[model samples]
Target: MMNMITDMKFLNFFKITACLVGIGVATSACAAGSSVLKIEEEKKVPKIQTIKKRDTASVAILGDSLAVGLYIGLTHLARKNEKLKVQKYSRVNTGLVRYDRYDWSKAAKKISQTDDSNIYILMFGANDLQSIRENSKAYHFQSKGWVKHYNERIDEITNAVKKPGREVFWVGLPIVGKSNFADGYQYLNDMFRARAKLNGITYIDSWDWFANSNGKFQMSGETADGKKRLLRAKDKVHFTPAGYADLGVRVAKEMQISN
Candidate 1:
């Protein structure tokens, strides 16, 4: 009877030890599974796209039909720089000489007040070849009185658009295929260059690009790469896309260099 009681106690003790070992193994397996799940959760976390801050410049294009052409090229060029912003304010067949139709000074001042622009591009004198309305009378183009009145109008427009931190670039008129129109544009370019210098504005001379070696206007012009291409349209007043592209690239390069 004593031997049987002792053997029973030993078997009971062995059974208890096996139960403890099984519990420990299960607990260790559960802990390992939990560690694996935590690693997977970290891997499933999404990555976010972040935009970097860049240098920026605000540009305003102000003028007539020629300005519209310039704006097309300028806008294309500005997009090359992710930070460049371009605003266009162009009037078709409008100029400083024709204030009765559309006053440039008032328009410029309004636009300047509306936006904070660092660069201002001025291109005009296309429709200024016609007669100007001054003091309740019409003055013929190229006349002494007409020139004087036009100069005053130019000064008014230039001064009105200026702000504290704005830099102005006055682009000269390009040569037209018509001799009479070319003459008018040449005279206007002279006035533009002189007034721009007087008002502390940079003048961009576009005549040489459109003019041939003989200093005459040509429908086909050489690009920056010296490849001859059709740059002018049939009307001779506006530029072809290729012409604007070439000019726009050059202008953009100059703008970058200026800074």
Candidate 2:
């Protein structure tokens, strides 16, 4: 439970800080009248604080490298939105149910125990596609039994974190690669949407930004000013910095000030 919450949590900083800027004065060794243009006084950058937010709202992200927000772009988003309490737990390379992989249960336990009322954001499945199952060598999604087990484990995670005044959001996977994986991606996305609906969790569709009118992944994304630009990284599996910014802003907008 804690894993789910911590994984998606982001911090919000509302306080501003002041800094002093000094204009370059002539060094004793230089011409005394020569001076370089510089800031000559202390100034405070007004805090661009998180909007009025619920004291308890939080997010936890879980999944593979994508969920972890690798690359410079994702790191920038995290730095910019530190106040949102968005925790992330993505392994370098893995998916939802690797046989020896870490599960959300461990983290979920901590979040569930917290006294604060908050929301969770779950981002899993990248690794699950080929993850080995518990007590066996078989991978997840290979059989009905395994799928059922996978879904049940998800439920267990939710149950552990269940409480009044709390909420959840599940972000579905986007299409990736250029082959059979595309079909698999769509299937998993469909399952994710269904699971989110059944569990009464908020579902964020990566496809909305990733897909085209014909339902295939769109390599470019719409910018704030409406310009379309390539948003995915070279791998075409993840987003660029601007892409993360777009996603983060959209999320902030959807949450609607949380309070």
Candidate 3:
């Protein structure tokens, strides 16, 4: 009887040990599964932040028609990127400060904010190249110091946008086909580069990639996004949706800004 009882106790102890072992196996399996899930969860990249932090980044555009809406609806899409709050400060047929004293005065009065944290992206020279000499809108160029005034005006405009700590990106003029106007474009691009270096700003050279083998304004096939490059319409001066998206991609890449 005693031996039988001892045998029963031994079996009971074995059964208890088996139960503990099973529990440990289940616990270990659950832990391993949880670890794998956590690793997978960490891999996704977030595109936009719905809730803004205390510090908000603001960008403003200061250019001519390009800023006013020249390309593949790019500016609008860029503004809706679910990331940036982009504000365009473009005036058609207008540069940094128009040669017209009255227009410039009115433009200056319209200004309200000038903070360094405010980023400004500027492209100009399309209109300033036009001769508005002494109230003559039709005159292309008879002024003697046109280059000098244009350069100085661009400098002043750049400095104004600087806002002490504000970031500035000045996109250079593109190469154009058959537009003797491109000479002015090249001169303006050179000036922009010099001024950017002087003020420690980023000078984006659109002319480099936008130029064709003939050294004129040409689209690189379709923009990186499969959109055809015809957004400039027949004018080939502005961007199509595809074109702007392509430009936006380049801009985002340069600035390391999110989409």
Candidate 4:
């Protein structure tokens, strides 16, 4: 009878050990499955990409009366963007031709040395339709000598503003109300364009922007909001406040700072 009791006790102990081993195996399998599922879920997640924003532009506007108008317009447009900064260095009745009154090449060199601006906008040729004196010799407008000297002046101004990280933009004259003035301006625009290209500087042409469908001058034009407004002053050479604002919009677009 003792032998029978011993056999029964051994059988019961064996069954308990087998049951414990099965439970441990089941637990280990569940943990392994959960680990694999977690790894797969991690793989399915998308990676996030970062995008960079454009840098701010510090603009310096230098020219004649038209540049003054451009400064006003850019100021108004820049009011909305804190990243854009514009400074005007324009004078009335001043241009590249008359060194006796104001030397733009000297002024540009001075600005380049003193200012921290990255962009320079040059608008002249309004008061430059006159004669240019060199070595006490007069070179009349449209003369070969005058053209050569004017082109050299353009180069001087362009080189003055063009630094290691600076950009230069030469703004061409727009159409005037008087046909004679308009023709003169067209001649000047060609020179400005050629010189700008030769110097690797950008030239902003304002002729077509202010002209009618027939390529003639127009007094009224559409603004940014698509409304017709008087763009030119009564003098027909300079821009009205609204006209300048429109020009500002176009320039801002070129600078890639437009809202």
Candidate 5:
């Protein structure tokens, strides 16, 4: 009964997250036809305007709600370093697929104008597991055509942020409380890792940071003092405040921000 309850919790969490992202359980059937879909050519990275260099430093945080949690954590840790200014450009519920709602490539250009700093922290894809509209065509999630279109968008966003003397830290998605959600994230993470490497950006793997000892999704994790604390929010999607702060500390350190 205990095992059954645990399994049910995982299933419920997966279904809820997928539904919230506008992906219905019926969408799983779309996966079968993915191989039959035609893949498009990957977009070439274009040259963006050269942003002004300044003595001041800033780190632009970009993505969806997960980026908001990441920003909250980064703000607490990065403020200690007076030289580093952490700015958030993330919009909640926005993803690479939802240009009609919000476009990160365009947002990146505007943010570059405001900050003009070299460092960037990008975390996306939590809200992107649904169908995507491309060139008057719609591609379902996990489809080969969807993969092609998604990669193109990722490249577009990455290129829009690249400037002279700039560094981008692309943070990968963390493991959620459901196996299906975890699988989706794993696919997204692989894309992030490959694309970040291809684009010469740093990719931050966050799966283990929120995973259990057995590499499973877990709600609680050990702090620096080895004391276990709740790291997940009730939704099992976003992080708790404590969880974000802890994760932010790691990110700040990775960005070389020290007081």
Candidate 6:
């Protein structure tokens, strides 16, 4: 009888121990699940904060001399708008075709890494009507090889400036007095437009803005006040102060409309 009683006691002790072990395992599982859920919740907060941080408009103007004029105009506009900021990174007589003189691709990448501006305005191709040298061979302007290489350079600049939550605006070259120059500028504009579309950026067409009613190059145009003023410089390549201011106004209007 005593032996049977001892056996019963052993069975009861085993049942108690098993119940305690089951409770401990359930508690530990719940704690581990809670920790995993907490970690997942923490991971989602930073992305939301990063998106919110990039909501302001800061303009970064880059390119050749034409871009310098546009930057002047934007600088003036920014003075009136407290929220707007404008910065320039342009060089005279520089284009993608002449890499030996000025390597715009490398310059653009460097600028993008350093500048915190969310908006980029680029205007080039004014001086690109030359030969491109690659692999010790020269590709003359308008040739298939030239076009291919020039388009790649465009892609390089576009990719360099493009970032999440950033906007890019490529200003097309305006009409020139010289027929040959105008033809080349038109071709460059076509390429710029196509690449801008493919890269999902904005292309500002300045051709019509500076052209006369007959759609030809004109030295003068009407200002915001509707006053007839000289817009083009003597060389017919660069713009006068008034011309750049008008161009700036056009770009400013675009920025406002986009917002």
Best lDDT goes to which candidate? 4
Query: lDDT of all the models against the reference?
Result: 0.77, 0.57, 0.59, 0.82, 0.79, 0.81
The order by descending lDDT is 4, 6, 5, 1, 3, 2
Better of 2 and 3 by TM-score: 2
Those runs of model 4 whose alpha carbons end farther than 4 Å from true positions after fitting are 1-55
Backbone clash pairs for candidate 5 read none
Q: Find the 10 residues in a row with the least total lDDT in model 4.
A: 45-54
Superposed Cα deviation of residue 216, candidate 3 (Å): 4.4
Model 1 TM-score, 2 decimals: 0.74
Q: What's model 5's lDDT at 82?
A: 70
Could you tell which candidate, 1 or 3, scores higher by TM-score? 1
lDDT of 4 by residue, 1-259 (tens): 9999999767545544545465444555555555655776667543221111235888899999888889999998888888889998988888888888898999989998998787888998888888999999999999999999999998898888887667778889988998768888999999998778767777788888888879878899877678899999998888898999899988877666746
Model 5 poorest ten-residue lDDT run: 32-41
TM-score of each: 0.74, 0.66, 0.64, 0.77, 0.75, 0.76
Give the per-residue lDDT of model 1 (tens digit) for 66-137: 888888887776667667788889878788887888889889888888877877789999988888877788
- Candidate 3 residues 46-130, lDDT tens each? 2221222323456676677766552224455556575556666667777643556334323432542543335667777666566
State the lDDT at 12 in candidate 3: 50
Q: Which regions of candidate 5 fall more than 4 Å away from where they truly are? A: 1-57
What RMSD does model 3 have? 21.4
Residue 101, model 3: Cα distance from true site in angstroms: 8.8
- Candidate 2 yields a Cα-based lDDT of 0.57
Please give the distance, in angstroms, between residue 254's alpha carbon in candidate 2 and its true position after superposition: 2.9
- Cα lDDT tens digits for candidate 6, 101-167: 8999999999999997878888999889999999889999999999999999998998899888787
Tell me the tens digit of each residue's lDDT in model 5 across 1-259. Answer: 9999999767656655665566766555344223223221123432333333343567888899999998898787666657767888888989998898997888887887778766888999999888998778999998999999899989888878877788788999988986668788899999999888778677889888888889888889985446789999987879999899888877766655664
Alpha carbon deviation, residue 129, candidate 4 (Å)? 0.7
